[model samples]
Each structure stands twice: as C-alpha cells, then as structure tokens.
Target: MSKGENTRKRIIAKSAELFNQKGYASSSLSDITELTGIKKGGIYRHFASKDEIAVEAYKYAGSIVSGKIHEALDRETTATGKLLVFLKVYENVVEAPPFIGGCPLLNLATESDDGDPVLRENARRGLDNTLELMKRIITEGVRSGEFKADLDVDALATFALSIMEGGIMLSKLDGDNRHVRSNIDSLTAYLKTVAAAS
Candidate 1:
C-alpha cells in the first residue's frame, strides 16, 4: 500500500483502540496523536474531522469483529451448532477481547447512545448488524429443522443478545471471565432445549 493509505489505516486502527479504550467523548485528538505518534496536522490530513475518524475507526473495529465471527463459523455444520459457536465467541471477551477495551459494540452503544449524532448512529447500526446476524442464524435453524419452527426468531435472538451482552458487561466490570463463560454455558443449554432432536 501507499504511504498515505497506510497512514490512514494506522490512524483508523489506532484511533479505534483509543476510542474503544476510553470513549468517543473521552478521547481527544492529543490522545490519538500520542497513541499513533502522528502529529495533529497529519491526522487532520487523513481525516477531515475527529468525528470522521471516529466513524471510520468504528467501522474498522466492527469489520474485525465481523471477520472473526465469519472465520470461526465453518466448524459447525448445523444451524444450532453455528449459533452456539457464534455465541461462544463472546466467552473469550474477558480474556481476549476483540478490541483493546472490550466488546466494541457494547462499549460504543453504552457511551455513544446520546453523544455524537454520527457516532450514536454508527453504534446503533453496529447493534443492528449483530441483531440481524442472530436473527439470520435463528431463521436458518428453524428452516433446517434444527430449531423449533414455531419459535419466535426475533425474541429468541434479542434474548440471546441481551444475555450475552449483559454477561460481558458484568464480567468486564467485575474483572471476571466466569460471568461471561457461565452465560455462554447457560445460553448453550437453553438453545439445546429449543433445538430439534435427531
């Protein structure tokens, strides 16, 4: 890649960590500059504004998370297996978070909900993307006869997302991975009951 392109990506990657570690409102340009070792003018050269950087950085982090989920999905053949594996990804959040801070989706949503207009929308979109993925998995499970056909896909996905996110938040706050791991186990057990038998 060209020098300019590399710089842009570095800015995004570094800023993503900064924003996720601190927050959109809490992170400053100087903090970004210190983290990236790039001058303020250099950063401005690549991003028109800090908001632009935040939006792009968020997209960058989101892409990494989405890629991780897709890469690990091939191990499961059944729809329910795929969903469980997907949820298990969160089990590692406490030990090995996708980002420096934690789950970017959760962090961004909690902090940016009423902050920056553009950032708030970006966080909302990130949330929607996750929910849509869960919904898609549940829908496929129902169609494949792995999940009960009569189950409410929307509600199920929402419940699973809520449980996982809540567990993650609690674990992060308490400095314990047990909370998330237990939630994953509980979710797996619950889904198994709803899954169809051989």
Candidate 2:
C-alpha cells in the first residue's frame, strides 16, 4: 500500500480500538493521535472529523464480524453444519477479549441513539447487514434441505440477530459470559431442531 493508504488504515485501526475500549463519545482526538502517533492535522487529512472516524471505525468493526461469520459458514458444507459452526463461533467469541467489548452495533446503538445521526445510521447499517447475512444463510439451509420448507427465514434471521445481540448485552451487564454462553447453547439446540425437521 502507499504511504497515504497505510496512514489512513493506521488511523482507522487505532480509532476502532479506542472506540471499542472507551466508546465513541468518550474517546478524544488526542487519544487517537497519541495511540496512532499521527498528528491531528494528519488525521484530518484522512477524516473530516471525529464523527467521521467513528463511523468508519464502526463499519470496520462490523466488517470484522461479517468476515468471521462468513469464514465460519465457509468451513462446513451443509447448512446445518454451517449454522452449528456459526453458533459455536459465538460461543468462542465469548471467550475472546476482543468481543468482550461487546457487539459494536449494540454499543453504538445504545450510545448514539437520539444523540448522533451519523453514529446511529452506522449502527443501523451494521445491524441490517447482520440480519441480511443471517437471512442468506437460512436461505442456503433451506436450499440444502437442512432447514424446513416452512421456515420463516426473515423472522429467524431477526430472532437470531436479536438473541445474539441480547446475549452480548446481558453478558456485558452481568459481567459474566455464562449467560451469553447459555443463550448460545440454547440457540444451537434450537437450530438443530430446525435443521432436523427439514
């Protein structure tokens, strides 16, 4: 990559980490500059304002989750296997420090709603993207004969997304992963029943 491209990436990466760790409202431009070792003027060269950086960072985090989910789905051939893998991946995410910050969309939604339009829009898009991905996976499962023909892919996708985000929020609130893990276990079991009925 060119020097400019690398610098932009560095700023985004650092901003993502800071936002995840301290939240968008709490993280300051100085914090980003200090962490990235890039001057404030340099940051402005890449992003017009802190809100812009926050929006980009939010997208960056959501893309990370999408990539991980896609990878898990790609690991198995059958729809049932893919669903199982996806649930298991969430279980594993509970054990990872990175996810300890919780879902970026959930975080941003809680903080940005009624406050910042850009941040709210970013969170909304992240959630919409997640729901779309789940819908696609459920559709695949149906085509593969791993899901019942009567299944409501849209509802299931929304429910799955809600459960995952809800579980993460509960985990963060309770300061324990047990609740999240249990919810995930239940989700997996539920997915198995749906797959078996196909």
Candidate 3:
C-alpha cells in the first residue's frame, strides 16, 4: 500500500478500536492519534474530522459483526437451523474483546442520540436491516413448514431484535455472559413454540 493509504487505514483501525472501547462520544482525535502513532496532519490527510472517522469506523465495526451473523445464517441448511444459528452467533460474539462493549449499533444509537445524523442514520439502517433479515428468515420458515402458518413474522422479528439488543446491553453493563445466554435461551424457547414441524 502507498504511505498515504497505510496511514489512512491505520487511523481508521485505531479509531475503530477506541470507539468500541470508549464509545463514540468519549473517544477523541487525540486518542486515535496516540493509539495510531500518526500525526494530526497525516490523519487530516485521510479524514477531515472526528465525525468522519466515527461514521466510517462505526460502519466498519457494524460490517464486522454483521458479517459473522451472515456467515452463521448462510451456513445453516434450514430456516429453523438458521434461526438457531442466529442465537448461537450472538452467544459466540459475547466471548471476546471487540464484542465486549456489545453491539456497535446499540452503542452508536444511544450515544449519538439524534446528535450525529450520519451515525444515527447508519445505526437506524443497520437495526432495520437486521430486523428485516430476521423477518425474511421467519417468512421462509413459515413457507417451508418450519414455522407456524399464521405466525406474525414482523412482530416476532421486532421482538427478537429487542431481546438481543437488550441482552447485549445488560451483558456489557454487568460484565457477564449469563444474560446473553439467558436471552438466547429465551429466544430459542420462543421460536420452538412457534415452529412448525417439517
């Protein structure tokens, strides 16, 4: 990579880490520069402002976590399997650092709080897209006889998103995985009750 490209990437990477660790509101350009070892001028060459880095960094983080979910959902051969896989994916995500602060969408949504239009819109889109994905899976499950014919896919999907986000928030605040597991278990049980036999 060119020197300029490398420096830009370094800034984005460092910003992502700090944002995930301290949140968007708390992280500053100085924190990013200190962690990246890049000069303010060099960073300016890449990003115009902290808001720019935040928008890009938050997008990067969202893509990372979403990629994992996409992978899990893609690997499952059945709708029921995919549904279960979604729960498992969150359970696994709770294991380590990047995910320790919980879902970036939730963080950005709450922290931005109608502040940064870009970040808030991105978070809104991410959340909406995630719910849509879940709804699609549930819709397919019903068509394939894996979910109840009369099931309310949209309602269930909204609930799934709520529980997962709430669970992650609680897990992060409490610094424990139990809430995450509990949420997954509750989701699983709820799905089973609504599932249709193949």
Candidate 4:
C-alpha cells in the first residue's frame, strides 16, 4: 500500500476504536487525531468529513468481527454445527471480543438510531447480513433434513440474532461473560429441539 493508503487505514482503525467505545457523536476529530497521531489536516486530506470517516470506520469494525464469525462458521460441516459455532463465537466474544468495547453492529445501531442516517444505514446493513447468514444456514438445514422440515427460518433467525445481540449488550454492561454464556446455553438447547434425529 502507498503511504497515503496506509495512513488512511490507520486513521480508520483508530477512529473505529474510538467510535466503538465513545460513540460517533461523542468522539471528536481531535480525539481521532490524538489517537492516530495524525494532524487534523492529514485526516481531512484522507476523509472529506467526519461522516465519511465514520462510514468507513463502521465498515472496518464490522468486517473485523464478521470475519471471525465467518471463519468459525466455515469450520463446521453440519448446519446444526454451524449454528452452534455462530452462537459460540458470540459467547467467546463476551470474554475476548475481536474489537474493543463490544459488538460493532449493536453499538452503531443504538448510537445512530436517532442520529446519523449514514451510520444507521450501515449498521442496518451489517445486521441484515447477519440475519441473512443465519437464514441461509437454517434453510439449508431444513432442505437437508438436518433440521425440522417445518421450521420457520426467518423468524428463528431473527430471534437468534436478537438473543445474541441482547446477550452481548447485557454482558458488556454487566462486565461479565455469564450473561452471554447463559444466552448461548439457552440457544444451544433451543437448537437441539430444532435438530432432526440422528
């Protein structure tokens, strides 16, 4: 990468971290400059505005966590195993998150709900991608006879995502992994109920 490209990435990384922790509205350009050690002019040279930086930073943050989840999912051969892996990844993140703070999608969704339209849309896309992944897995499971034939894939996917995100939020707020672990346990039990006979 060129020097300019490298600098832009550094700025995005630092901004993502700050945005995850302090939120976009609270994190200032000065804070990003301080963290990145790049002057204001340098930052502006790469990003036209804070909004632009925030969109890129949010995408960067989402990719970090999403990449990990995809890796975990790929390791499982069965749809049931893939679902379990998905839940387990979130459980692990409660203890050792891929990014600082917590889940980027959850953070950005809540932070931008009443604020930045760009960020809100980005967050929504991130969430939609996750739901789609889960839906695909469930749909495959049903077709393969690995899961119940009559399962409501879309509804279940939405429920699972909500449970996972809620668990993360509670775990982060309480400063304990038990909350997420409990949710994961519940998810595991629920998955078993949906799984077909061996």
Candidate 5:
C-alpha cells in the first residue's frame, strides 16, 4: 500500500479500540491524535470527519470478530454443527475479544441508539444482517430435517441473538466467562431438544 493508505489504516486500527472503549461522541479528535500519534491534519487528510473515522473503526472491529465467526462456521457442514459453532465462536470473548473493550456490535449499538444517525444506521444494518444469517441457518436446519419442522426459526434466531449479546455483556461486566459458558450450554441443550432425531 501507498504511504498515505498505510497511514490511514494505522489511524483506523489504532483508534478502533479507542472508539470501542470510549465511544464515538466521547472520543475526541484529540484523543484519537493522542492514541494514534497522528495529528489532526494527517487524520483529516484521510477521513473527512470524526464520523467517518468512527464508521470505519467500528467496521474494522466488527470485521475482525465476524471473520472469526465465519471461519469457524466454514469448518462445520451440518446446520446443527454450524449453529453450535456460532455460539462457541464467542466462548473466548471475555478473555480474548477481537478487541480490547468487548463486542463491537453491542458497544456501538447501545452507544449509538440515542445518537449519531449514521452510526445508528450502521449498527442496525449489522444487527439485521446477523439476524438474517442466523434465521437462514435455522430455516435450512428445518428443511433438512435436522431441526424439527415445527421450529419457529425467526423467533429462535432472535432469541439466540439476545442470548449472545446478553451473555457477552454479562461476561464483560463480571470479567468472567461463566455466563457465556452457561449460555452456550443452555442453548446447546435446547437445540438438542429441538433436533429432529438423536
């Protein structure tokens, strides 16, 4: 990459943790400059505004975690296996999150809920897309007879997302992975109950 491109990337990479931890409105250009060691002039040269930087940084963090999820899912062939893999993907989030603070989706979504239209939209987009992916998996599981035909895919998908975010939030708050571990066990047990066959 060109020098300018590399600098821009460095700025985003460094500030992603800052934004995720401190939040967009709370994270000033000064904070970014301090964290990234790139002055206002250099930062402005790459990003038109703090809003732009926040969007890119949020996306950067989201991509890292989501990439891990997809990679793990790719290893599982069955729908039930994929579902288990998905839940297990965040098993280490409390101890070794993709970033320092925690889940980018939860952080940005909660922080941007009452502020930053652009950010709120991006957060919603990410969330909606994830729900759709999970819904698709559940739907396929039903069609393939792996999951019971009567399963409510939409409701289950939404519930699973809630469990994931709630578990992650609790895990982060307590600095313990037991909540996540419990959530995984509960979800796994529930899925086994819904399985079409043993």
Candidate 6:
C-alpha cells in the first residue's frame, strides 16, 4: 500500500476504537489525532469530515466483527454446529470483548439511532448482515434435514439475533455476564427443540 493509504487505514483503525468506546458524538477529531498520532491536517486530507471518517470507521469495525463470525462458522461442518459456534462466540465476546467497548453494532445502534443518520444506517446494515447470516444457517439446517422443515427461518433468525444482542446489552449495562450466559442457555435449549431427530 502507498504511504497515504497506510495512513488512512491507521486513522480508520484508531477512529474505530475511539468511536466504539466513546461514540461518534463524544469522540472528537482531537481524539483521533491523539490516538493515531496524525496531525489534524493529515486527517482532513484523508477524510472530508468527521461524518465521513465515522462511516469508514464503522465499516472497518463491522468488518472485524464479521470476520470473526465467518472464522467461527468456517470451523464447523454441520449447520447445527455452526449455530452453536455462533452462540459460543458471542458468549466468549461477552466475557472478553475483542474490541475495547463491546459489539460495535449494539453500541452504535443505541447511540446513533436518533442522532446520526449515517452512523445509524451503517449500524442497521451491520445488523441486517448478521440476521442474514443466521437465516442462511437455519435455512441450511432445514435443507440438510438437521432442523425441522416447518421452522420459520426469518422469525427464528430475528429472535436469535434479538436474544443475543439484548443479552449483550444487558450484560454490558449491569457489568455482569450472567445475563448473556442465561440467554445463551435458553437459546441452546430452543435450538435443540428445533433440531430434527437423529
């Protein structure tokens, strides 16, 4: 990569961490400059405004999360195993987050809902992508005779996502992992009930 490209990526990486922790409204250009050790002019040279930087940073952060999920999915062969891995990944993340704060989609969605349109949309897309992943897994399970054919893929996917995200939110708010653990247990039980007979 060129020097300019490297600098832009560095800025995005630093900004993503700051945005995840402090959020877009609270995080400032000064914070980015401090975190990246890049001058204000240099940052401006790459990003036209804070909004532009935030959009790219959000995408970068989401990609990190998506990459982890994909990695976990790749490790499993069966659809059921993939779903279990997905839950396990979230459980681990609750106990030890990969990022500084927590799930960027959750954090960004809650903080930017009514505040920043660009960020809100970015977060929405991240969430939609997650739902799509779950849907694919469930659909595969049904097709492979691992899950009941009558299952509602869309509803189940939405419920699973809601349970996971809700658990994360509660766990973060209370500074305890019990909420997430309990939710994971419940989800596991639900999954088993839906599984086809061996």
Candidate 1 stretches greater than 4 Å from native: none
Give lDDT tens digits, candidate 2, residues 83-139. Answer: 545445556444573443657778899999899988888888877777787788799
RMSD of each: 1.3, 2.1, 1.8, 1.2, 1.3, 1.4
For model 2 the TM-score comes to: 0.88
TM-score of each: 0.95, 0.88, 0.92, 0.96, 0.95, 0.94
Candidate 6 per-residue C-alpha lDDT over 1-198 given as tens digits, one digit per residue, 9 for 90 to 100: 999999999999999999988888999899999999999999999999999998998888888877887898898998767766655666755458756678888988999998888888888888888889899999999999989999999999998888888887888788888877888889888989998989
Top candidate by TM-score: 4
Candidate 2 achieves a global lDDT of 0.78
Clashes of 6: 0
Give model 4's TM-score versus the native structure.
0.96
Cα lDDT over the full model 5: 0.86
Q: What Cα-based lDDT does every candidate model obtain? A: 0.85, 0.78, 0.79, 0.88, 0.86, 0.85
Return the top candidate by lDDT: 4
Q: What is the number of residue pairs that collide in model 1?
A: 0
Model 4 agreement with the true structure over 1-198: per-residue lDDT tens digits: 999999999999999999988989999999999999999999999999999999999999988988888898888888877876655776756558878878899999999996878888998899889889999999999999989988999998998888888888888888888888898889888989988888
Better of 4 and 6 by lDDT: 4
Instruction: Tell how far residue 133 is off in model 3, in angstroms.
Output: 1.1
Cα lDDT tens digits, model 1, 29-110, are 9999998999999999998999999899989988887887887787677776676665577676767886678888888889
Residues 136-181 of candidate 5 have per-residue lDDT tens digits of 9899999988999999998989888888889888998888988888
The local distance difference test score of model 3 is: 0.79
Please list all clashing residue pairs in model 2, or write none if there are none: none
